[model samples]
Target: MKICVLNGSPKGNESVTMQYVRFLERANPGHTFTTENIGQRIAAIEAKEEEFKKVIAAIESADAILFATPVYFLLVPAQFKRFIELLFSHNAGSAFFGKYAASITTSIHFFDHTANEYLHAVAEDLGMRWTGSFMAKMDDLLIEMHQEELVRFGQDFLTTAQQHPAIRRTYLPITSTRPDYKSAGIPMPLDCGDKQVLILTDAAPGSNLEKMTMRLASSFGKAASLVPIDDAKMNGGCLGCCRCAFDNTCVYTDGFSEFWKETVLPADIIIFAGTVKDRYLSAEFKQVFDRSFFMGHIPAFAGKQVGFLIEGPVAQCATLQEILRAYPSLQGANLAGVVSDEDGIAMAVDELIDSLAARCLRLSKSGYVAPGGFPAVAGHKIFRDDIWAEMRAFFRADHAYYTKHGLYDFPQSDLRQRLSTTFLSLLLSIPSVRESAQKEMKKHMIEPFEKVFSESPVLKRQKKEG
Candidate 1:
């Protein structure tokens, strides 16, 4: 069977993700695999109609489609995303209809599931029979055990493709309700005080997103500075080139750096406004995320209050919601709230927007950035470990930042704790002590936190104080 591999890496065939795809090809010599570097050649694909036709022709002829890419900003690269946007804008969805599809991604395992789920949903939206996906940690392919598992995964995908088994859709189609959102006049202004409120948006002029952003800006009154970011003008997308790693300097001499410095840095509260395009935000909006890779693994929005004003059915897209929530959490920012125009009633959405404004003000005034959730905690560790170890040589800027900010906080740094652990281990070696330790394990765990409750004005007093 002929399979078209949609290579979503900016490195084209040289990508680490493609290495795994090549392994699958070598293992399964019976099937033919052809690769298209859509990520690398997105400029050509978007500019030249003939180049795009060639890609569609490949998809039309293929029995199966393989989406191979590395996860960037919890999704596909901005270039690959733009290619998908082009496919929709150019009316090329028919090429993928009824095609067997599956995705494979390589990442630090930071939000890898979000990327895989995103592709699966996109495939389903394109009328493809998305069978399954294989996710791998960046170094998983180096292990023989993982290699064997990958082989089995490839075989299972091929067998499923040949059989063309019916699969339930993971995401239902998005239907816009009252997308052309109208603000119910001016809302009661939020008292932002000394907090710097910046509303960044990529809303197209006269679009529903534009209206939503306007409403949100007005809700903040004079305290908010709304700037419609031209994130679309940024690419030539991120090329995955590590040039910026050394100094946090982007290769592209764009106005993005200035925008980051001027708009992003001073803001205490940031509200992102955009419409849902396809399964996520617009590719233009994604360009902002992809281009921001220049900052490496740094949290640019740390200690800020973030919110969203979406002009589509964002509330319904769980995967999108998770990604959205993860952005603020993983970046060390607090989520004020995400309000979408899913409600058919304009007044209801307006009320929600007003409530969102109130929420942002309250959070800002209190200077409370809520603790990071699942994505934030796990993602921090992944980046922290990688930056401290193997990735250190390449990411000098990250290393410097991490060291200065005390981010290299490996638990092994505590010599006293290590000594205590060693003593405990030796004590537990004796049979009687071991049995006693096992019996008292749960009690010992609770013992340390007892002081925290009695002394600190923390969780213990939250019920009464809060």
Candidate 2:
């Protein structure tokens, strides 16, 4: 079997993740392996088109792919991510479909499970079946598994790869429109006169994304507005408290409330412009991202054209899902389109205002919803196998993955039962005569309850695994 390993560390060949690759090669000597240091090659490739062609050829021919990376700030390194961005600029669907892709990530403080899940989700979005995750923590234990785990990974990866058919078959779900005949449906015209557009931005004032933002704005009828993100005193950052759902206003009245009332409410199309900081939205953008909820149930941007302007590599669709989940205020808006890598800060702003205007015009005329539907999860339902896989990963006792996003919340209905059990258990226990025994029991009864109150979302496990 021939394979390609796309290593995603900016450290290049010297990364610890490469050590794992060496182990895998030793474990399975029969399989041919070619490694591409994506981080090291990304910068040099700009002047060398042939290098990308070779990389693309290798990817196309490979029976399986090993995406190995060291977790940087809980995501792929910026440079490595850029290489992936470039892949899309080429033929995105052509190279990746039907390939057996697995992820391997090395991290120090945290296990690589979340990072692997992100990659797996990306593969799923690209219509690729996820084989599985081969994740490890790079601590002292790494030395021990360097031999055995590598062999196990090599065998397992290949075994899974063979199960897939060699002939790639693309499945298109049955559509209302016939396959052979072009739908001669009446074409609709766009109307842009009375439409309004709203622009919301991190106000990086001079960034590449601003250009895309302006283009998006102009499409929406020249509707553009800028909301600066760097003000630290505003809203003290979203506390993840869902209070805004009912209150209809931010609890901390920094500048978010003012921005929403004075600027955000009046626009017909809203353009979200934010720079990428550490592989995620900037801190200022994050604060505004969180505070945007102040729009509440009032239908501020409902039926309005909305688009996102991003400054980094192409964002994973799953990350967008997470964002929607975190903020429900965006439910009714029409998602127009996205623009990335704006070229410069000034360009980003110009693009931001222009894009808002354009999006508003387009929204007024075409009235098209974004390719996918609202609350992205609703558009793409969770599969039975995915739920099962999550349960399986959970049962593996990979606590780091569970800690990051899964276990923090409990279902609301079950909370009463849990609280009852805790109260009853504590009340039923009698005090022991020994002081040490009494102290221990009291601590046990009180500590768990305190922890429960402090953490609103209780840890919840799936009732049934797939």
Candidate 3:
């Protein structure tokens, strides 16, 4: 198989992650692997628009992609994030479909899960088949830098790559699903014919974060413009207090708002790049993120798309989700996509971006359509015929039904328990459940399974599916 190994370390071939790449190459001599360094080079090309054409061509030829980086704050390096933004500019988002992808990260003490999740999400969003993650903590690997573990990681990648088949077996078509739409053709006030995408990243030119951003962008986009954000004066921190409730502006009024107004608002999309600390967004990144909230209630993000490139360990993504869900400025915005370091980040970000992109595209092509009244899931075939059929069986009041389904051991008051299960699942997915209500509901879920199964025929079927 022909594989494209996108090395996202600014250190280039000198990066420790390269050792793993070497191991993979040695273990699977039968497979072909090509490596590229995006790093500061992307930012250089951003200044020369014509060079991007060649970069995009190379990416389209690759069969599978390997996103290898060193974790920074539980996310990909900032430059790699910038590359993604540039890829969007070239409209390379569609090029990722059906391709096999894997993420390998090296971090000293972090879990590298967030980085994996974010990268996987990017792949999934592009309709790619994400195999899995290969994470190695430098500190942990120091104890087992033996040939066996390195060989195992390489073999695992090779085995997984062999399992799933590629959608475009060879040679990607020049045009995407929406051929009329070009990366350079994003909607703008003025017409810019075939104008390559120009993106500025909040990454240092020589850093690992920057390398990851450029590598991803080059792999996925037409041409990229990467400008590093290296202003020491721009560094700041978020004050935990939610003082923006009154004036809708941050009270601490540092240089953060200026960064957004000066750097972010002017672009077609804003890509925030940073690392994670203590399972949360970096102080500097969070400070800017919080300060950007000054556009509150005025619909600053009504049509904007915000993307994030974070580097950290295990919990970076959870922290990112919590921040996004609670951020006021992003209320009406579309979250384009987040590339993290683990499978979970990819899953969550994919769902969020797909939903956001679908709705935004629908609205762009057609006007908003809202039901005259509240909509319910009761009659939806996806929920009723598929989901409810299983739910109903568990809540049925017939003890015989429970026994047939192997749920006879369920406790008393099973009807209430079955009903509560649906609610709990919904609460877990939907973030609106109150702690007090959840606690009270848990107390009422203890019940006999047989009695519950007999009470509802609908629940009986649901139990079977469960």
Candidate 4:
């Protein structure tokens, strides 16, 4: 069986993700694997029609298509994303029809699920038989057990592809019509006050996206600033070169870094506007994010109130909605609101946009950023640990920032908690103490937090205690 591997890493064959591809290739001798450096050569592929056709020809001839990529900003690299866009735009999707598809990605296990979910959906949308996925932590191949598991996974994929097994779609087709939205003029206009409100969009002219973004900007009044990233003369998608890792300095001499610090980073409230292309936001929007990787794992939008003005089936795309929400959440920012023009009623969409703008302004004024949810919480820990260890050598700036900001709040450093835990463990080892502790464990669990329910005001208590 011939397998066409779509390599989505910006570093091409040299990427760590492709090493996994090499593992599979070496493990499976009978099956031939042909690799295309999609992310590396995306520019040429998009510019030259013949290059794209060559790639399509490979896909058409292959029995299976393997999507191997690194999770960049919770999805595939912007370049790989553009390849998907090109595939759909140039009517080359038919090449993938009826082919078996599977994906393998290498990341720090940071939001890998979302990335794989995106790939799985894309393959399904391309009329491919979505088979299985293998997620390898950056160094999983080094472990003996993991190495064995990887071989097993590789064999299973070929077996599955050859068997012609029935496949079921995981995602339903999105059916939404963009409403003709008109600003109803906010009943109670919000005063952005001293907040630096920034509305960023990749809205196409005469499109519903433009209308939605315009409505949002109008709701925020003159104090707000709207910038169309689509018009920005961006050099290109991020090249996975780790030059930025050393000190947050990108190799590109373009105005992108200046755009980040001067425009995006200074905003107190940022409203992202876009039209969903396919399963997610436009590749241009994704490029903004991927390029922003120059900032490393820092919280660029910390304490900001972030909102979204989308002109797509946001309600239907649960994963996209989650990705949008998680982005703000992970950045130490509050998800003020997400307004999509999913409803056919123009009035309904207008009201939603107005409400979102009002909420964003109100949150910004109060300086009230909601507590980070699971995405942020888990992501913080992931970044913290990696910055202190694996990423420290590459991202020295992150290491310095984490140390200075106390982001490396490792549990091992909590001497008091460690002592208490050790003492409790010893006590619990005794039969009598263990029995007593087990009986009261449930009651003790809530004892510390019970004051919040009974106390006059926990907020005041916290401040007073401090």
- TM-score against truth, every candidate: 0.92, 0.44, 0.40, 0.95
Cα misplacement distance, residue 43 of candidate 1 (Å): 2.1
lDDT of each: 0.86, 0.56, 0.52, 0.88
lDDT of 1 by residue, 1-466 (tens): 9999999998999999999999999999999999999999988998898999999999999999999999988999988998988887887889999988999999888888988998998898899988788899888999999999899999988999999788887788877656456777877677777888888898778877777777888888898988877643563677888788999888888778667877777899898898787788887778788888888898888888999988788876788999988899878889999988788677898888888888888888887988777788788889999988889899999999999998887889999999999999899899999998899999988898878867887675786788
Q: Write the per-residue lDDT of candidate 2 for residues 1-466, one digit (tens) a residue.
A: 8889988765667777888887788768898888988766766654478988878788888888889887653456555655665665564557777788888787542324446766675555455666776677654235764556666777878888878844332222211211111112222323456655555666444445554444544444333444445433462444323355444555676766776666766666566776554334554554454466454322245455666666654443445334533232334466566655533344444544455455557664666544444333331122122223443342332223234434323344388888987786676574543445566876766776776555555343222332
Clash pairs (backbone) in predicted model 1: none
For model 4, how does the per-residue alpha-carbon lDDT over 343-461 read when each residue is reduced to its tens digit?
86778888888889888888888788878888889999999987787879889988888888889999999999999999989988999998987899999898888787667586778
lDDT of 1: 0.86
Reference-based TM-score, model 4: 0.95
TM-score of 2: 0.44
Q: List where candidate 1 sits over 4 angstroms from the true fold.
A: 231-233, 425-445, 457-466
Model 4, runs deviating above 4 Å? 185-188, 450-466
Q: lDDT value for candidate 4?
A: 0.88
**In model 3, what is the error at residue 333, expressed in angstroms?**
27
After superposition, the stretches of candidate 2 with alpha carbons farther than 4 Å from their true spots are: 109-111, 145-147, 165-272, 275-316, 320-466
Clashes of 4: 0
Clashing pairs in 4: none
Q: Lowest summed-lDDT stretch of 10 residues in model 2?
A: 174-183
On the 0 to 100 scale, the lDDT of residue 404 in model 1 is 93
Candidate achieving the largest TM-score: 4
C-alpha lDDT of residue 335 in model 1: 94
